[model samples]
Target: MICYIYDGSFDGLLTAVYESYYMQEKPEQILRKEHFLPDFFIEPIYIKTSKEKAYKVYNAIKDKVSHEALKYVFYVFLSELKESSTLIYRYLKIAFKIGKDINLHMHNGIVLSVHKISNKVTNEVHRMLGFIRFKFLASNLYYAAMEPDHNILQLIMPHFSKRFSSQNFIIHDRKREIAALYNKEKWVIVDMLKADGEKLFLNNNDEVYEKLWKQYFSSITIENRKNRKLQKSYMPERYWKFLTEML
Candidate 1:
């Protein structure tokens, strides 16, 4: 068994895939460097991230395959699922052979798995678009915090960036210790772990809006028609911590 370890980045994974194809040595497993553990029986190969190699593979997929297939590849990577690198490599092998029609091959296990993982990540991105609640901070920046199950900050940024194009904002994914900051123009992601000392300074009037939102939420709910189970189905409990009305 051979294990290919790479830096934890989409480009890095693509580089590894490119090397595997060129070297004619497919790996049994593809793991991020941080997560890779030595196996006595398995030969471990460490892959360095190369932008040139990554770009070559990326362009091949985009040019040879359909753009839609490329999008699916991106979504699957953002899923951060276990052994997703291996799954992506498997899906790509078939995708390259079958071309754009690979998406229609639902019977293929690798294709189906890729579709499922992509759907899961896309679903979370949709949920975050509606559920994210931003607060006005002391620095006059709109700030929101989330603990999403997937690495979706990049996926959801374009929507919010276009919607709130004039405003400066930050969406912090506490679970991943990363934050996306928009400066009324373009957005960028930053490392924001607890130890980073990046404080969120909220204005005094922030509490006023929070109270008003909570009050409005309560007023709109029909007491007799309240259904906790139904509400929970639409809005999971995991997101309650970031929701002002839920607080």
Candidate 2:
């Protein structure tokens, strides 16, 4: 058995897929080099990322498969699952063989796994859209922090960018130490350290707004009608840390 290691980028995974065919070595597993654990029984091969090779494989998937299939591959990669790389490889192998009809083959385990994982990423993207709470910063920037289960920071950028098009904002993913910064017209993702993030100060009036909002939330709640279970079902306890009312 052989294992192929990549740099953990989406392009790197595609490049590995390209090499697997050209090198004629069928790997038993494809893993990111940063997370790879040595296997005594498996021979390891390190695959370098190539934009040209990655582009060719990417185009092949879009042309040979469907545009929707291409989306599945991307979302599955963003899932950051330990076996995501291998799952993508197996998925495309079948995808290329069967073409766009691969989506209908839910009976196949590999196909089912890909769909399930991709759906999970999509679901989180939807949830984050409503869950994100922004606070005004001292610099007139809107800042919010979250620690989602998946690497979904990039996926949610479009919604916030359009919604807050006239304002500057930053959405920080505390777990990943990454943030999306938007300046009215454009947005970009950047690496942010926890210590640096802590240096950002909230606007002086932000506390007043938070207090008023919390009070409003409390005033609207009827003690007799409160259903902790239902509330938790809609807004999971795991996300309470970042919510103003929950705080």
**Model number with the top TM-score:** 2
Model 2, 1-247: lDDT tens digits are 8899999999999999999898877887899988798878888999999999999999999999999999999999999999999999999989999998999999999999999999999998998998898887767778889999999999999999998899999999989899999989999999987666667862335577678779999999898998989989988899988888887
Candidate 1's C-alpha runs over 4 A off are: 195-198, 201-205
Candidate 1's C-alpha lDDT? 0.88
- Superposed on all Cα atoms, model 1 deviates from the true structure by an RMSD in Å of 1.6
- Badly placed stretches (over 4 Å) of model 2 are 202-205
Instruction: List model 1 lDDT by residue over 14-74, tens digit each.
Output: 9998998877667988888877877799888989999999999999899988898898988
Ten residues in a row with the worst lDDT in model 1?
195-204
User: What is the TM-score of each predicted model, taking all chains together?
Assistant: 0.95, 0.96
